[model samples]
Target: MIKALAAKAHTYVVLADGSVPNPTRNAPGALTGKVNTVLGILAWAGTAAGVAGVLITGAMMAISMRRGEGSEHMGRLGMVLGGCVLVATAGPVVTFVFG
Candidate 1:
């Protein structure tokens, strides 16, 4: 009886195909599409805001320097640096949020 059971189990195992199935074989549905679209919009907005911030900060720094306001110039330079950081980090931020 024990041998017979073992043989039957072996036959069952041998009958199964060895191919592994993919977890994400099916394409994402509507919800995924909406999420991706929202994420894309957020990324675009962030990039635009960062660029505008950088431009405004640069102008402020230039004006401050022209007036010889050394302290204000440094502050404006810091803002410009921060804006650059924002631009550089936007993509990662979006991925972090949506991924």
Candidate 2:
């Protein structure tokens, strides 16, 4: 019984010390954590700004229509400009996620 108990304890000790190996740690040096944090924040910011641009464009169009005195052409132009910004922001987010 004592020998069995000792064997079990030894097994437990070995298993307890085993660690999960991180493959990233085995690779060549990569960018530091700070870079990742900054990139992540920038990605989130881009998405937020894109959504905000869309909202602003829509609001401008709505308000202008209600006023009934401004150029519809300018309102359309605002929408186009917002769409362009949204696309520009999307590119950064995609790269951040998959690259």
Candidate 3:
């Protein structure tokens, strides 16, 4: 079975014109501007949400501390910070992988 499948597989190195075929990478032609605008808006929203998360978490932590409670809010703060890190790195990681 493996041998038969291997024999059926085809690999093209050159085209009929004796030229090497190269894959092209590009964004969509017509909606490129709109797509970029949407992406920018989403990025901005993610950043704003992250900021709000941190601020809220900080406030909760401060209130908890004032009550002489345990450091339970630390976990929430850590989660907020982790989310901020993810938001910060998402665009760069996607660009590195696909660009």
Best by TM-score: 3
Winning model by lDDT:
3
1-99 per-residue lDDT for model 2 (tens digits)? 999999999878877899643434433345546767777787677667667766776787788788985666566666667766766777567779655
- Tens-place lDDT digits, model 1, residues 1-99: 999999989767766656543445355698789977997897788778777877777787778788888655567667667876876787788679645
| TM-score between candidate 1 and the true structure | 0.53
Least accurate stretch of 10 residues (summed lDDT) in model 3? Answer: 8-17
Candidate 2 Cα misplacement greater than 4 A, ranges: 1-31, 72-99
Ranking by TM-score: 3, 1, 2
Give candidate 1's whole-model lDDT.
0.74
- Candidate 3 achieves a global lDDT of 0.82
On the 0 to 100 scale, the lDDT of residue 20 in model 1 is 45
- Model 2: how far is 17 from its true place, Å? 49
**CA shift of 65, model 3, Å:** 1.1
> RMSD to native for every prediction?
8.1, 10.8, 6.0
Tens-digit lDDT string for candidate 3 (22-65) = 67967677687897788889899999999999899888888888
TM-score of structure candidate 2: 0.45
lDDT of 1 at 56: 79
lDDT of each: 0.74, 0.70, 0.82
